[model samples]
Target: MRLPDKTTKMEQAVAAIPDGAAVMLGGFGVPGTPFLLIQELVRQGKRDLTVIKNDANETGMGVDHLLVAGCVSRLITTHLGLNANAIKQMNDATIAVEFCAQGILAERIRAGGAGLRGILTDIGMDTELGAGKPRVTLDGQAWMVETALRADVALLHAAAADTFGNLRYAATARNFNPLMAMAADTVIVEAEQIVAPGALAPDDIHTPGPFVDHVVHIPELTQEYAVVRR
Candidate 1:
């Protein structure tokens, strides 16, 4: 059987996302954030988005764009220390923000991808994060049952990809790309470069083609792709 090419236009991929959808954005600040995808999402004016990300990236970038556009309704993330816009919006009741412990958040998404129901941990049992959460006692200790997280769509940035949609992320940029790729109903990638199927060896592929729905090739990296910090 011949493998079909999944390459597509960024606009079409992003436009498929409807209003009031849950979206998982892959990135650690600027490195792996799909800037073009986010821009398109903003341009298309998608609203009431519940964004699941590691952090609310600083103002003028990433999720901040969605926040500024009033596209986000709730933010599921680890922190908002860097993004004053997110903080302001959350504090002012413009958007609801749910905080999760770093490792626990990753585990929750991993569980979703694996088709598990949820995870139990003592990580935040005594904190506000654990408040009102379902708890179970295993052995002799109590643990919070954190539900798995799945998204309607996942936007990822890849260092490179093949026409088949096999993706490889660069260094730290790989942070949530691989995980989010598996946990979403539709996974769209903005690749710096898209090559022939065989161009990316199987060993180097971080996200296999079958898990990705669309691969959008970016002609050139913009100013947002530049390293803001090392």
Candidate 2:
């Protein structure tokens, strides 16, 4: 018995995402984001997408590219402070933006991966984000029901990956990559470095290969990420 190799071309992987799909992107700002995959997705011109991520990314990068290309219809995220374009789009009603508290967003995705329907919380119960959302009472206190978030496809970036698709992230880049991998129906990963199956030690593997669908190797990051890659 042998483990399957999930390595694939970047173009082919992004091509599988259909228009109007719910997609999860693994990243917190520039790190851990699949820039190449996002670039390919933009080139493919898939539209009407519902994107879930931690941030809107800055102008001319990551999620902003999708916004500029008019690819995304709705963005489920934490904040749009970093990207003026994202704020403008939200204000102009060009894109519908759903804001989630950072911790709540993570828990929602974790709940999805854990196969739970949703979780009850009081984090946003008194805020606008919790407004109009369903609620329940527990121990004489009200808790808002925040549903889990699962995606049709997940785009991830890893520092290194083995042939079997085991992945490892560097530093802060690990954010959201592992969780998103589990919550998505199809998980596609872009690795800066590719190694043999056993090259990555068990302890170093952040996201196991079984949860991953496709792995693409990119030898070098684009120059725009020169400072970021540092």
Candidate 3:
């Protein structure tokens, strides 16, 4: 059976997000970040949010705008080195930051999507990253139990999407989008191009329509380089 078209306006796409919400932002830098939706979120003045992402984006772009708007209270990400503003906020206790290993972060989200409690790994064992986490021993080997990561809403950007919400990503833009889509209760996508269902080949679909709740079509395509100019 075909799914209903989930296309919506930017405001409606972010309306479901409440203050203090845990939001998974799909992007490896700006490639897959939903900038338009993020802009609307900033305009809405929602605060005290917990944002989950691969990295804190560079200043004045993408996720950095959230930091600038002071909307994010906590950040769960691989690193903040790319975003000087985030680093300053973390240091000043303006925002709390949790640094997870990149691979572990990905696996945790994947575990959440797969309905697993968590996965045990030795990646951060005996290190600051695993300092307080519980560890279990199996076959004389110890591993830290990393809980699965889930979110209330996931913000995503797609290269193209069908009316039914099936998504296609461009190049590295596919990085965290598909995983977050599955792990979040609400998945909202900002699509560069919107087409009819079946326009995208089955094999080309990166995220299925069933996992997506809403899609916002962007009339103009905007690209931002991931590089940080210091």
Q: By lDDT, who's the top model here?
A: 1
Q: How does each model score on lDDT?
A: 0.92, 0.91, 0.89
Question: Total clashes, candidate 3?
Answer: 0
Ranking by TM-score: 1, 2, 3
> In model 3, what is the error at residue 75, expressed in angstroms?
0.3
Better of 1 and 3 by TM-score: 1
How many residue pairs clash in model 1? 0
Better of 1 and 2 by lDDT: 1
Q: Between prediction 1 and prediction 3, which has the larger lDDT?
A: 1
Q: Against the true structure, what is every candidate's RMSD?
A: 1.2, 1.6, 1.7
- In candidate 3, what are the lDDT values of residues 82-166, reduced to their tens digit? 7899999999999999999998999999999889989999997888999999999999988899999999999999999998889
Candidate 3: pairs in clash: none
Clashing pairs in 2: none
Decoy 1 TM-score against native: 0.97
lDDT of 1 by residue, 18-69 (tens): 9999999999888899988999999999999999999998888889889999
Quote the RMSD, in angstroms, for model 1: 1.2
lDDT of 2: 0.91
